[model samples]
Target chain A: MALPLVIDIAIGQLRRRKRQSIVSIMGVALGVGFFIAVASLMQGFQQYFVSQVIDIAPHIVIKDEFRTPAVQPAVAAFAEGAVAVRGVKPRDEIRGIRDARGKLAALEAVPGLAAAPTLRGPVILRYGARDHSVALVGVEPERERRVTNIEKDMIAGRLEDLRATANGVILGIGAADRLGAGVGDIITAVSPRGVAVTMKVVGLFSTGLTALDQGEGYALLKTVQILQQRPNVVNSIRIRLADITQAEPLARVIEARFGYRTESWEETNSNILSLFIIQNAIMYSVTGAILLVAAFGIYNIISTVVHEKTRDIAILKSLGFTEGDIARIFSVQGFVVGAIGAALGCLLGWALIEMLAAIRFDFNNPVLRGQRGFIMSRSALPFIFAGGFALVSASAASILPARRAARLNPVDIVRGAA
Target chain B: MSAPPLLEARGVTRILPGEGFGAPPVRLVEDIDLTVGAGEFVAITGPSGSGKSSLLYLLGLLDRPSAGAVLIDGEDTGALSAPALARLRLARLGFVFQFHFLLPEFTTLENVMIPMRRLGRHPQDEIRERARAILASLGLQDAERKLPEQLSGGMRQRVAVARALANDPEIVLADEPTGNLDTRNAATVFDVFARIVGEHGRSVIVVTHDLDLAARAGRRVHLVDGRIVSDGPHSPVVPQAVA
Candidate 1:
């Protein structure tokens, strides 16, 4: 038969059995939906995880295989060489929260370089007998504005207030609210080394970001360095590069020259990243099982169709339909069903995603890293899942039925009661 | 014209092995020689269990004859590959069954269009025109678009007749085309067959238990216990019918 006529015949056959055709399509759609759901969730987890890793470290990081002070001298040398390389890191460090003055000044001013040291630590604060521990950071008033968005989070006080007071601290609005401290309230902090200091809450900030807005305090870097008893030494050197994603290579260059251990942003949170990968693998595998079951359902429906049409097959054969044509007719039916199911499933998956996003579903499953809840699926995984599931189910559904149709004894079916 | 008959067979034996282990082989249709010629309408008659259907199947290439040779247009069927055999069947053979074996899912038009599609050529309008013409010839012009399920028994059998002629086959092999019809319906099916063989110049071999229908053919071949008992010109009414 002409190929298009074969398709027409196949499609007409399906139209005749409208209910059966619809059920088969639904079977494929369910299979695809399950697959897409798993794929979307897996993809969301990956994005959340990869970003977290990037949040803490650079796009790439290279550390000394060993993490010990035994290589301290080589570490310094590695740091110096990394600084010597051109286009290595950004010429400025915007550690806006706090500044580590005397400790970071000399290293940052090294010619052909851009670096800054900011005070980053936690402090204990007491308000009317209620004491809570919160993170405290000190930044250079002028240079801090370049890198970070801390200044944009001014709740009530001004940046001039931070520059004017000798003992001034900027508090995250959440932290200040919990402490019941206004912009002019006084707070006390004790350094890790047993040194105590008191500072006025001259400025309040709110970034509207969860991590930065709660339990955080900022002060002048020089004042922080003095209080912490690290006059010329900073806790961590923050590096920005011409290409942020090139941190691993940059860290490698620095580590190679200075012999110091370095870590990229990705490596900083490797555990959660591994967790995301593992979850995706598991979820897709589960979806595969669902697809298998759905395919099985489709197979069952098609098998019935083949059995019911035995007499029709005999007539077609007797009328000169080659075995290939018979098989193709049925296969065409399956392909149409699968394609339709996949298309519908795609729409359904998108609708479900929108519905989920609307509800702000929290995927706070402890197994997921960072307790993150809402994530949007933004990859080809959804289409792949739906299309893959439909294709596999559709083709699989046709196999046995098509074979049966091909193998039928035309004489027997035609002569015998069908 | 100088070659073998349009259909020629020699010692056509078919032995089917019983399924899986130890069951003895069953002789389904054995040592049968049958022939029909151009422009001839022959009828094969037998009691049930006489392998009348099996013999027709062997001739039609619906199933392979287990042993022996059957030639169509002088081409030995045994030597052709399965696909080649299928092609041979498509190119030359047509079939009608006791039941109206029209595809219930398709309309009478599509049923007629099937064999034409197997031709795999000709435009849509041409195919449709031919199918409509065939259905019209069968006096089923208005019902061509009606599904087989919607057709009456007589109409359905007429549709089957049209389908058998769709490819313009040299021979139409029917296994009891009228076994399920009433007397009138059976006579109507026979009437359609007579016109097809007479006007179209194509041969037809119908298997029937109905004596009236058998008597109407150009010749009659009788089978009993897997053997041909009588082969003759159409009738018990003709004294030389068994000669």
Candidate 2:
């Protein structure tokens, strides 16, 4: 019977001081909102880091480190022995060769590959009197198109025509624009060794990558080989696999044979990934400080309640309320305040997160300038955080006040003796 | 045979611990034999500093006697624990003081319901209805919702009486309950005592200076210098000797 009365009194008291209650709830809401949003952002960053591994490149890349890529066709020898190295071997690596004869044979060994080697190099070209230096890659048109989507990036002519001539080449649109040339135009190119070669532009490309489009050219490897005079040498052995997921173990096997270093896409940007984790940790710690502030506010409210209700407790004793009962009443009051504040805080915090999510605060993190800000997750519950904070804060805040209420003496209370 | 007295004191005495830098302990009150029967009203009066209030307090179980026995309902209170004494007080006794300490924040109804609710003898509705009826008997039926500050001194004292009787205590103690009232209000308050005792068959012990009010009691005992100098049946008497 008295418990309801006590709860009613608690509600009335809280209602009377609406401003204080709101302020306390706001403090808790801030903590909860910050905590949840930070957590969501951290999760988003983690997902981005992992997903970027597969999105940006192959699952695995194999290359000889501390040495420039060899200019030879070693892929056939490597692929034949690839099965002995402890994992599934898909398509074989292919050297930068012109004919595609040896590379196509390796591709046929693993029937899954619909493609073969992609050629790549650096060349200086001149067109219509003004020219610029750019990276030049040559490949078998049909096979290279199956491996990478170079045809979709064509700005002019057709990818099939890139293999039509020994002197045919393709240029990225930016590279063409820099050289003031287009399809069917002739260009003079030279390697770093000043070995001059003339090529006819059969197609132009634009991959939307500034470095690649502004500096890359494409040609048939046979023409590139004829022009570079390198019969059996290449920069790298680009392998075509059935699935990228199998590439890592396959690359490890291939690397073991050739004694080359292997890399996965995740290894490309390790520093940025680590920065996301560190930033998340710092954010959570700061949010914890905000929760501490909310706890302090709860303490203040309970302390005021203890002061205001002391004499009423004295009269309660005269009426035969036990010390324990009095303590219970006060503790109940503290809990009620905490519960209400927590509930309100949860609402406010949730609303705040929703609003922030709508705005999407799309900016880089201060510590990770490349990272996008503000990620929303259904699993990030601001309310739960607020609720846990409220319970702990209320219990802690009520302890001293409850003890004081219990210690009151009836004789002294009625007479003003204590 | 008649039942034993509700309260009996055999040479009850009280001593205060030394104060003012360890002065010697002083006997606050000393008593001989005394008995209060179940439905008997007894008033204790004294000059200031004569320890009449102190004796009343010790008898009311608010404090322990320095030496001697106070048997309440045939059990020695000294043999009981402090909490047990409190329980006994709650169950059997009520107090009205010179100042109306009727819990200022509570309404007249809430204040009167306190003891009955504390006792937990009845359901909530039963307690509330009984408190209302008791307040009505005290002529505070319409004032049940009014706070202490809203009621006059006389009305507040009457409310206190209703509250005291709410639990049906065997004895009601008042230390100048009408002390703050005017002559007319004081007469009205004292007038409630006879009517209540007659109808309810409850005991009352009052301490007061108004001889007119004192004369109305069934029995009056006087204390001077911490000793009973005169006691009679509501009749004026010359001092037989110094207390």
DockQ (C-alpha based) per candidate is 0.52, 0.20
Q: Model 1: runs farther than 4 Å from truth?
A: A1-3, A30-115, A119-135, A141-143, A152-161, A173-179, A205-216, A241-244, A278-290, A360-375, A378-381, B19-21, B234-243
Q: What's each prediction's clash count?
A: 24, 4
Encode model 1's per-residue lDDT on A1-418: one tens digit a residue. Answer: 3457678778877888899889878877776765776577667767765654344322433222335534344456787564433444443543232233432364355433334456566678776676766777766666555434466657677766778987898888778877888888888877776777888988887655445556778888777877777664455555544455666666676566555466666566668667877887787777777767767766776688788888878777766677888888787777888888887777777776666556543554433433445575767768875686678678778887988898787877765772
Superposed model 2: Cα runs more than 4 Å off: A1-5, A8-286, A360-373, B1-4, B8-34, B49-57, B62-70, B77-86, B102-106, B209-211, B221-243
lDDT of 2 by residue, B1-243 (tens): 766678887888888888888699877777746687766677777776677777777777776788998888778899987667767777888877666667665689988887777687888899899999988877889999998899988898888888877788888877777778899888877777776667778787777766668778888878777777777785464434322
Considering summed lDDT, which 10 consecutive residues are worst modelled in model 2 chain A?
A: A63-72
Per-residue C-alpha lDDT of model 1 across residues B1-243, encoded as one tens digit per residue: 586789977789888898789988878777888766788898887777677788888888887888888988777888887678777777788888878777676788988887777775667679889889888887899997798889888888888888888777899888888767789988888988888789989888888777777989989887777888778984343232321
Please write out the lDDT profile of model 2 over residues A1-418, one tens digit for every residue.
3645555445555666778767765766566666666666566556655554444233444443523444334554576554343454545654433344554465447645444454456788987679699877766777666656667667787878876665888887788888888888889998875778888988887665566678888787766665566655554444546666666676566556555465544455567667876886787678778777777776677677666666666655554556666777667656765676676666665676577667634564433324444555556354576577766777677778778877866555555531
Q: Candidate 1 at A90: error in angstroms?
A: 35
Candidate 1: give the TM-score of chain A: 0.74
lDDT of 2 at A393: 72
CAPRI class assigned to model 1 = medium
- Write down the TM-score of every candidate: 0.83, 0.64
How many clashes does the backbone of model 1 have? 24
lDDT of 1 at A346: 76
